[model samples]
Target: MFTSMTVINILLSLVFLYFLGKYLLNMYFEGINRPEQWAGKLKQGKITRELQKAQRQYGDKSRFFLFWLQIERIKKEQIQGTFAELGVYKGDSARILHLMEPTRKIHLFDTFEGFIVADLAKEKGEAASYTPTNFSDTSVDEVKRFLGNSDTFVFYKGHFPESAQSLDTEKYAFVNIDVDLYNPTKAGLEYFYPRLSPGGVIIIHDYSYKWEGLVKAVDEFVRGIPENLVLSPDTDGSVLIIKNSVHT
Candidate 1:
């Protein structure tokens, strides 16, 4: 018995609320994410293109902002080594990280074909229901095209650990692991932690309970490492590991 006008009004109200909520969230996040150096960076126009993109396009500003702050800290501390990402689903985060520091080389590892069957088999929680096809929509060529200029970028188009075999003693300043399951996340930690430079960083995405397998992997890995995890207030719950300046 609702009139057409009433329906239209309800829809309009919902649309207004949606935008209002988003605006409120962005404002709140900006306050906390803005560091003491933020004003200086803005006044000096020192903000990276990636940070701007995160602020304008990404829904999880909390997570992206935290990444920006961490990268700043790393640079300030004079951390040495290249950057890397284990799950380059579509080169989004990789692009962000690269643009943040275009001078450093960033290694991108992915199947370019989605989750591996072997890896997917061990998933639990939200990722448990995913199949090989879950994230298979992307390709290395596509990612490269999106990121533009291949300079300072390296693509390892295959399963990780194996894909990263070419990596030997090279140190890493920052590594991002967003594989969304247990095995590869664990593998990434195993391969990168030892190679991570002292005071380097590794960020693991999906560390919340929704990805039980990811949680399990991180929990087990952290127990064996000297650094503790610093959780992020992002959309998917990211966790960080900043390597000790001197540790085994």
Candidate 2:
């Protein structure tokens, strides 16, 4: 009886270990294989320092960090075109793109009045954080100062789709869209996707984030795109859509 009991216990232990190992493997594959999670790993102190050096020499702004990272990656892959960003906010990202690619033009589109407060309020069934008065209080002059007479940067102030429709740009190497709304997100993609240069990148902020509408729009947009366009996620709810060179 004692011998039989020992064998049974040993078998049980083996089964438990097997299950444990399988669980660990699944977790590793699911988490580590994710692009956004991988991007987060690239944000180490060393990477931050290198980015800071590039920014300081070009322009001292936090927004450039993302643009620099993207441009550097694209350059490494030998991609090419001008950069464009929807929703300039304070113009930090646009400033950085201008610095990195001085020869290329950087076009920024924004209402500059915070956001459309009434639309957001209706969506959330309450008063949202953004208000019309917010834009009135903020100033783009400081952001303009970073440009310093550089004509490469252009700002389009107004609602999207309407404002973007007037744009006559032929192609863009990099596009950053941070509209943070279903309609604007959809509009931006529709307006910009056709203009994306071969092997270009479209960076969308707040994609798959906690916000319901943003996630919904991102999911819908990704589903409609071709399979070759890789969607890489970053730590801060950003998704980088790389247009395959052969697609354009």
The model with the greatest lDDT is 1
Local accuracy of candidate 1 as per-residue lDDT tens digits, 44-87:
98986566656667667677767778888889999999999999
lDDT of 2 by residue, 71-160 (tens): 767666766667788888777667656656667778878877767754465333122455566545444676677557888888777888
Off by over 4 Å in 1: 1-33
Query: Over 4 Å off in model 2, which ranges?
Result: 1-66, 76-80, 118-128, 134-136, 228-235
Query: What C-alpha lDDT does candidate 1 achieve relative to the native structure?
Result: 0.87
RMSD (CA, angstroms), candidate 2: 13.6
- Local accuracy by lDDT, each model: 0.87, 0.67
TM-score against truth, every candidate: 0.86, 0.66
Pairs with backbone N, CA or C atoms under 3 Å apart (clashes), candidate 1? none
Residue 248 lDDT, candidate 1, scale 0-100: 65
Q: Counting only residues 3 or more apart in sequence or on different chains, how many pairs clash (N, Cα, C under 3 Å) in candidate 1? A: 0
Per-residue lDDT, model 2, residue 77, is: 75
